[model samples]
Target chain A: MSFINYSAKEINCKIVYYGPGLCGKTTNLQFIYKKTRPEAKGKMVTLATETERTLFFDFLPIALGDIKGFKVRFHLYTVPGQIFYDASRKLILKGVDGIIFVADSQVDRMDANMESFDNMKLNLDEQGYNLDNIPYVIQYNKRDLPNVVPVAELNKVLNVNGVPEFEAAAFDGTGVFETLKSVVKLVLIELKKGA
Target chain B: MPQSPFVMYDEEFKELTLIIEKLLREANSKCVYLVDKDGQLMSAVGETKDIDATSLASLTAGNIAATGGLAKVIGEKEFSILFHEGERDNIHISVVGQRVILVVIFDKRSSLGLVRLRVKKASEDLTKSIEKLLSRMQAGAAQENILKEITDDDIERLFH
Candidate 1:
């Protein structure tokens, strides 16, 4: 739910980053945190396991430029990508206005990506959000890695719905903002329809 | 303009916050706080300083809102208790009368069941106060006599 603060005249929306473990879910957020203008982004906190895998979640409040007269603030969150953290992931998906599905582009990690996508769908269904219609985007990350799945093959399996697909090297900051922009824009459009 | 912000509640409702405080203490829990559906902190108790109550309040409400949405999807109304287990401890977040969020954080020392019971009572209490507050807010009485309530120094301090 977006809050329309009459006092501040700003609209705040929550956007979540979700995907399989090590699919660069946290990296996508980290990249944004690093690249955003210091004035535009709030503090970013990432709590991970001993191996540095995301444990609970990473939260970053990013203020995108004002669209029309309303200040657009997106609270970005990333759930732990590990499979055992399914419960935690479901909890994090709560009240999400938009989503970016980061699919690991590794050829060997195809199964994890598929399982995570399934988990995402199941969780969304339980939360009354339908990916088929909700504001969503997709990114095939690790494009720079060798033995990475070709875009077409990845799309054949992952892009069944054909949401905006991006080839991202999230660590180097490739296609990160494009993915973010597309999702935010789609969410704004959805909000506009309601208005 | 009530005696106590919580005094408007009858005796049963009046004991709500105390009950939550006592329960947390007994369970050796870290902290407990009540937040509105929009994540505004209504009241807090225990060691919540290190914890970002603002974010916690917002996220807890978000958790509640999502559970409510899930309820609608499956032909249910809304979940009363949502117990999420962390690696060491756990977070017990629930909706109270569909108006407020009651959150309790505890480690292995505290049980989820106890937290749930106390929150149930607190929810009843909070709902009444919240409803009354909302009606009062809508009446626009809160906006009246604004200039008389504060001194010039207070206004000046706001600028500095």
Candidate 2:
């Protein structure tokens, strides 16, 4: 849920980056954190294991300038993508305003991608949100890798709803801002409709 | 929309800040924070110059959410209160009105008993204000429609 603080003239929205294990979910966040100007971003928090895998989540708060006098801030979060962390994933999706499903495009990870996608829908339903209605987008990550599934096939499997999808490497920052911008736009449009 | 955005006006903000500031003083706490369940920091007071309020608010909500999940597994409705004691400071986290998280960070100067007592009284007042704020937001949401004034051009400009 977005938090509109009239007193502070600010609007805060939560956006979650979700996908299967090692699909570059945390990498996307790290790239964004590295590139965002110091003034525009807050400290990035990572709760990970000893091997640097995300155990809980990663959070980054960034100010996307102002819109019509209200300073718009988007809090970006990445869920622990490993399947065993389903409970943590559900917790992260509680009040999500928008979502970016970062799917690994490698041929071997297709099953993981499909499983995570289904899990997302189920968890979202449990939280009283339908995936179709929410402001959601998808990122086909690891495009730079060899043995990657074709973009057309990935779309055929995952983009049945055709909710704006991007092909990203995430490691070198390809398509990161584009995906972020697209989802934020959708979220703002949705927010306007409700208002 | 699944749920309306959490909105707070100036009046409610000041009222809440007053209650939190008072709690900070009475409880002898180093700091107090009012965070939305969605992890937005609504208001904070006391010594927070060096603290990362945003991260703290997010983690506090995560902690509460995880605990609430645990409560569910045990057939409980929710775990409303959470306390974390560090070597130097202790944090007292509680749910207020089931909508927001109330957090108090204190050190050796304050006792848990005193913080709990003050928090109980303050929670009552805070809950009342929160209820009023929610209703007001609901009533004004349609009429305000502030974002409706924003155009595609406005959104496009943000990317540049």
Candidate 3:
């Protein structure tokens, strides 16, 4: 859900990065955090386990300038992509404004990617958010890996709705901003449409 | 969107901030703030400069959500209140109107019992105010055209 605070002259929205474990969801956020100017970003909070895996979620709030004088702030969150964390994933999606599915592009991780995609749908359904209607984008992440699957094949399997998709090597920051910008654009358009 | 629309106009914002200020004073807490379940900090009052309100808001929401999930699996509807005791400071969190959270941060100046008592009363007041605000937003009285002034060009320029 987007919160429009006229008093503060700010528009706040939540965007979740959903994918399987090791899909670079957190890396995408880390890159954005590093690139954003100090005045434009807040403290990036990561709730991770002892092994550095995300335990709950990663949160980063960035100010995307202003739209018609209202400060447009997007809160970026990445749910713990481990399978057993389904409950945590569902909770994160409670009021999501947009989603970026960061699919690990390694060829051998096909099953893990597909499983996470299906799980995302189920969790969205449980939260009464239809995957088709929500503003969504896909990032085929880790594209620099040697054994990555072809983008066409990943799209054929995961992009059933044909949402805007990008190929990214998040660690190197390739296509990271592109993916974030695309999703943010889509979200703003949706808000303009009053959806 | 399954979640109801959220908008805070001047009147509603004033009422909510007033409530927080009163809660902070009554509870003798260092600060009082409100965050939506999504982790967006709505309003805050009292001595907040020493605290990272944004990080606190995000972490608190995540904590509450995790606890709420635990509540569901245990066959409980929801866990209404959560308290954390720190070395010098403590936090008291309560779910308000099922949409927003009321959080109070205190120190040696206040007791847990006093904070809880004041929070209970403040929660009731906040619930009513938030419900009214929600209804107004739903009715399209105050939030009908929040983005009416925003243009495609304005949105496009952000990326450039």
Candidate 4:
């Protein structure tokens, strides 16, 4: 349940990034942190382990301009991607307004990507958010890798409903903002429909 | 309907606000306020006038929500405090019984320990009030009717 503060005139929405470990969920946020003008963003908080695994989540509050005079802010969060952290991932899905599924494009990580996608659907379903309906987007990160899966095959297996997908090299800022923009744009459209 | 929708007669909410004010005063702080977990500004006291109390209330609630989310991920119960230390000024925030967040923004003349003690009492009071609010809400559509009872003028007040 989102808190609508009529007194503040700011509608804050929570959007979670769900994907497999090392699939660049955290890197996507780090890239956005570096790319966004400082004025447009707040402090980026991340809880990670020594080996760079996300321990809890990364939070970045981005101000996406005003709509009809209300300052619209989106709280972007990334769930810990490791399979062992499934419980943590489930907790982060509570009250989620939007989701971005980051798929690792490496051909060898195919099974892992599929597992994470299935996990995303299960977790979201448990949260009462339909994967097919909620404002959802997909990002195939690490496109720069030599062993990356072909976009066509990635689309065939992962893009079940033809959700907008992007080939991204998160470390290089590739397709990062495109993914964020599309999901956010969809969020606004949902807001317009009052859903 | 009870006397006032925005006003609380339950001694708990009132006393909670007073405790908050006392804490801020003792800290030589600027102001203080309590926001429910859902971001409702329960009671505010201080130079909240002319300032962005509404946004502060909502953001503080957001902070609590974020922290609560983190605690759950870590297998903890919940977070009750979030402190943002700054140069010359700082924001001392604490969550009360997971129901309301107590905030105190102070400058040079105070200690964090003192703020914590006062907030504990206020938190207890605020928690009781929220318990009542939740129970009242669970009582049924009466709460929705209460909102329905709001006049056009009140709705206008919300926008303006």
Report the Cα lDDT for candidate 2: 0.94
Point out where model 3 deviates above 4 Å.
B1-4, B142-144
**Docking category for candidate 1?**
incorrect
Query: Model 2: clashing residue pairs?
Result: none
Best by lDDT: 2
| Model 4 C-alpha lDDT per residue in residues B30-120, reported as the tens digit of each score | 7888776544466677777765664566567666767777787799888778889898767888877655678888766776777777667
Can you give the DockQ of every candidate in the order shown? Answer: 0.05, 0.79, 0.70, 0.09
Candidate that beats the other on DockQ, 1 or 4, i.e. the better one: 4
Writing each residue's lDDT as its tens digit, candidate 2 over A47-151 gives 999999999999999999999899999999999999899999999999899999999999999999999999999999999999888999999999999999999
In angstroms, the error of model 2 at B96 is 0.8
Best by TM-score: 2
Task: Give one digit per residue, the lDDT tens place, for model 1 in B127-146.
Answer: 77667755654454433322
> Which of the two candidates, 3 or 4, achieves a greater TM-score against the reference?
3
TM-score of each: 0.65, 0.98, 0.97, 0.68
Q: What's the TM-score, to 2 decimals, of chain B in model 4? A: 0.72
- Top of the candidates by DockQ: 2
For B1-160, candidate 3 gives per-residue lDDT tens digits of 4354478888999999999999999999999999988888889999999888989988888899999989989999999899999999999999999989999999999999999999999989999999998888888773346677678899889988
* Chain B vs. true chain B: TM-score per candidate: 0.69, 0.96, 0.94, 0.72
Ranking of predictions according to DockQ: 2, 3, 4, 1
Per-prediction tally of clashes: 1, 0, 1, 0
What TM-score number comes out for model 2?
A: 0.98
Please give the distance, in angstroms, between residue A140's alpha carbon in candidate 1 and its true position after superposition: 0.6
